[model samples]
Target chain A: MKRNSLHRLLSTCAAMLWASFATAEVTLNIGYLAVEQPRAAVLSNLDPIPDDDGLAGARTALQDNLVTGRFLGHGYEMTEAVVPEGDDPLATAKALLAATRFLVVDAPAEVLVQIADLPEAQGAMIFNTSSGDVALRDNACRANLFHTSPSDAMRTDALAQVLVQKRWTDLVMIAGTRPQDQAYASALRHSLTKFGLRLSAEKEWAFDADMRRSAAQEIPLFTQELGDYDALIVADELHDFGRYVLYNTWQARPVVGSEGLSAVGWSPVIEQWGAAQLQSRFEEMHGREMTSQDYAAWAALRTLGEAVTRTNASDPQTLRSYILSDEFELAGFKGRPLTFRDWNGQMRQPIAIAHPRALVAQAPLEGFLHQNNELDSLGLDRPESKCEAFE
Target chain B: MIRVATACLMFAQPVLADEIWVTNEKDNTVSVISTETLEVVQTYETGERPRGITFSRDFSRAYICASDSNAVQVMDPATGKILHDLPSGADPEQFVLHPDDRHLYIANEDDAITTVVDTETRKVVAQIDVGIEPEGMAVSPDGRIAITTSETTNMAHWIDTETQQLFANTLVDSRPRHAEFVKDGAELWVSSEIGGTITVFDTETQAEKAKFGFEVQGVHPDRVQPVGFEFAEGDTHAFVALGPSNHVAVVNADTYEVEDYILVGRRVWHMAFNRDRTQLFTTNGVSGDVTVIDVAARKAVKSIKVGRFPWGAAFRPTE
Candidate 1:
């Protein structure tokens, strides 16, 4: 449309190419923007009410991951810049990415997608550090973005596998009412069915005009302990009383619900294999524990770090190709080695079952070994996800 | 007379300190245990999964690693009401007090990141990516470097504490869980859960210096997970928490030998020593007890059942 002006401008730039666009540090500045501090009432807002303080829990997850990966060489360095508390994160992110071509965030999906389409986003890659929404992988999938957090489907599938292994085929579903929460509950229900489990009872928690009233009746109604059913499956993504539902059920059996025993990409107590060493260094850095986000982010970064290190270049396309190549070896967090799923860039890893005290167990438990390894059995299999990105 | 008594009562109340004085993770509350009282004093309610706990080096505040909430519930030690929440990586567990204590290092479990919070600002100034499943963290005695053990990868990473960039990631064995840089800063002893051994590494080269293991039965080969440990540099002796076995293996770091094994309780998680180093307190998670061990005798002096799943303990009594 503007070939005449483009020709003149291009000719001028071609003449001065060496003068203006000189080689540079090619620095990657990562900005993690959040309302308030990341740890405050952190999962608290998972619901209207905040869960217990997981400071110790999140400390081990400093890198946003504990996944094991090592760089072969060095070239790309990830630098981080934080926006002041109370500052508008989107604005801060836009400005930061304008200068730096790569970004990683701990914000929600709406904010993530918002920044993905920013004018400055033309030649950048964004890693979603939070927001496990599945839509990001499908309908909203963008070539320039990647997600380290597991999709809701991934988490649900993991939990379903744990249920299947335990043979806790009958699940009494106590679900919190939110669009996302409902979607999560429904997905788990579908997974339970898909994996050959059934929902014996289904209950919902409506948001109360008054928050206190809802908190009061939530856990008690969930009082059905272990024996009432094989297990209590609560899908209150919003912590609310999901964390409380651990042993607070009627039947008094082992609970695998929202807050307490949910499955995830990583766990802090997984000292098996070479994970402890990673945990140690992270603690030394942040002076605390690690979290789920820490594991995913670390894997994503390490994955990318290894790729860039191997390629020894800042070219994103080249680095991405190196990662997707079959020769990559990622052995950081989850002890056993792993690689990226071709369809979606999701790291194929194990789902750990954890409480605040210690990790209970990991999914695809010991004996349920599969052809490709039991750990990979937890999340979405290669056959299930429809994303053609990997294909 | 009644009005006078009420006024007196109000004035007699103690002033609360600014930090989260004490916490019990399994209990879902923190006991604002006064450092002044070498005893269980008071308790405060905190967010969910309050496991790893530590105070700012200055004692201005206390941080609890709430894994379930994916944040560190910061608290005023005085009132025990949460002061603010720091966005920590998820599943935060253990923490290391910076030698300066101005900064508190967080081991976030879920997110697998190490978050450094400036105690003065009480905000995360740096969030560095580390290995998968980061757990126990320790700062070098010289305060030059920070070390975290990512459990899943079974690796220990050394951070240039000043820059917070991961300078090196040293691979160890399966399930490398916890670490402690020896008091002298010469070497670091890292524990492995699934690997079931303690690896000693030269802090500089990150090379494996030595490894110590158990020589007895009942120690499930994989279950002989080495968790919490304490050692003196020149001193050849150290103590390691043997997971699920309910025992603390006393080892000689010089020769890489297991000198003795002292049984504690089921699923022993962590341990801390008294100022004099004469006594050791190890938390027995499954048995719900804290075993007090006499360092010299290498024997369990007492087993005190504190609460449901007691995880951490400390002695802040100044000499």
Candidate 2:
């Protein structure tokens, strides 16, 4: 081809591309509300928190959404509000609600409830992407709020199912001092009972021993009292001493719970079913591996993207109805299309069972079956849910 | 001219003395299942983490994508012995041999590049940078358009075979694990494992024609993870391996309607039809076996235990 003709072709194509970009009509704004959570006190020397954790996942989802959104003449915008410590979350949520109908919240259970109760957030749909509090799905369930974060109950059940499958029915639980740690312990106990597993003993770790300072003597004494159990389950939401309990256990047992071989929403180690792609993308964008909160935020925003694409509408009410309806299902890279449970408004997804290094397994493990959906076995099923108005 | 050539090749297809080759990912071996007996006649050790497998168009050599070894192993089909390794880049998970039988397009997952190799010379011809973790590779029937589905990018990138340039990037659902062109080459179907949807794209228009979602009673919609697909020639039905759901969705090609869900082994990955298209075999990853389906009955006829994790499969037709 001659240079003149080639230049003419390039100019024609560029003009057509520009014209196509000019015709986009729909714009969807997704708001992310999170607190700049302080780094948790860890027994290990490693830094536990990434400066931008959950927000990075949401940002990736926005880019992913825009990739498809462009073809449909839809554009996506993200609004982020990171609340500082002791600040009023209501103010941040209010500002976000005023800007967009869809909000992905990576806040605590109390903050989520507070935001959901705001009149400005009445008709808007908010996704709980961080809090794993069970009460949010129980008595505190709001009509407008949907949870992407797997509740404490879900996480415990996932671990329990894996234990039952592996025939590790005998458990020795180590509970932490924090309120959330106690709550997780309670949920684990309930999971054990439901799954027909016997809890050999429950030891209270007052968390007074900072393993970093006095681990050589204290860890040995702390884990000295133990019966013959197949697994040691630790509930340490504070990350106080869970990491230290793995190699220091008196009994030769596999440790599982918040540390060791634990159940997760997402882990960097997950490579099967095309999770490697997601991990690589997250790594390229954030310069680090994606955490559970990042995955939860991504899933929430991806759910919004799916609903909007399916319905071809940005209306919050339309999206809510579609998500609640049988037609609303979002594939969340958990080997299935995740859907919202009508009763609790909790998105049903397979929980990833992993240790710090590798994925141990996925739950709804081989034999534990449910009548409706296998994932239903992990959380509060329809018959047991106490939500006010279940569809 | 292509149609006439294809007709001649179809008529000249070899006899039914073929062997089924299953790539055992964990064991680093290939299980050769006899087509006549439906039994593993032999297992040959290959490179580490053998995944995708294919035969040259003329059936002279078998190429196996040894992902962990970061190379594609060429082996003698008759002897089941490794001959040489193709110059595959980092983590060559899946690949396809173009109809010309000359070029091999491999998805170097970790490198985020599709390495095109000249099979005859065993040389790297070209490497096109694609989306992150590019897994699935497919070449159109005409040998003109090549596609690589970038799993993380969630887009099926169409590359012009001649120019070696990506022309269109059609965004689909999440985590697209595999791509296949229909019989006529008018459409392309890309399976999104995480999204649980198989999006069909028009090859000419570069538009999404339709999307199919699988629903098996008692199986969560999210667990209906479509990974690999096999289209039965001359039939309207195509079989999709649903990961972890332990079922194969039989979808009607013309109408885009899923006709039936045939139960199979756990975590079914990829599949291949026999020379006669009478039997379809699926690699069940978790179960570590291959489920053979009788196409006429649309049922899983037998489960053959092969290896720790049987991933990809192909049939070697014997003359």
Candidate 2 at B161: error in angstroms? Answer: 6.1
TM for candidate 2 is: 0.80
lDDT of 1 by residue, B143-242 (tens): 9999888765456878888998888887665556688888488888888765567888998788888876675464324346677777633556888888
Residues B223-313, candidate 2, lDDT per residue (tens digit)?
6789999898775788999988999999999998998888999899999999889999999999999999999899999999999889999
- Return the lDDT, model 1, position B131: 63
Model 2: CAPRI class: acceptable
DockQ of each: 0.09, 0.29
DockQ of 1: 0.09
- lDDT for each residue of candidate 2 in A328-372, tens digit (9 for 90 to 100): 666565666688998889999889999878888898787787777
Residue-by-residue lDDT tens digits, candidate 1, A273-378: 4465566666676665566776666666655555543445666677666665665546554534455665666665666777766777766565554565454455
TM-score of chain B of each: 0.85, 0.94
Instruction: Report the Cα interface RMSD of each model, rounded to 1 decimal.
Output: 7.8, 4.0
Cα TM-score of candidate 1:
0.49
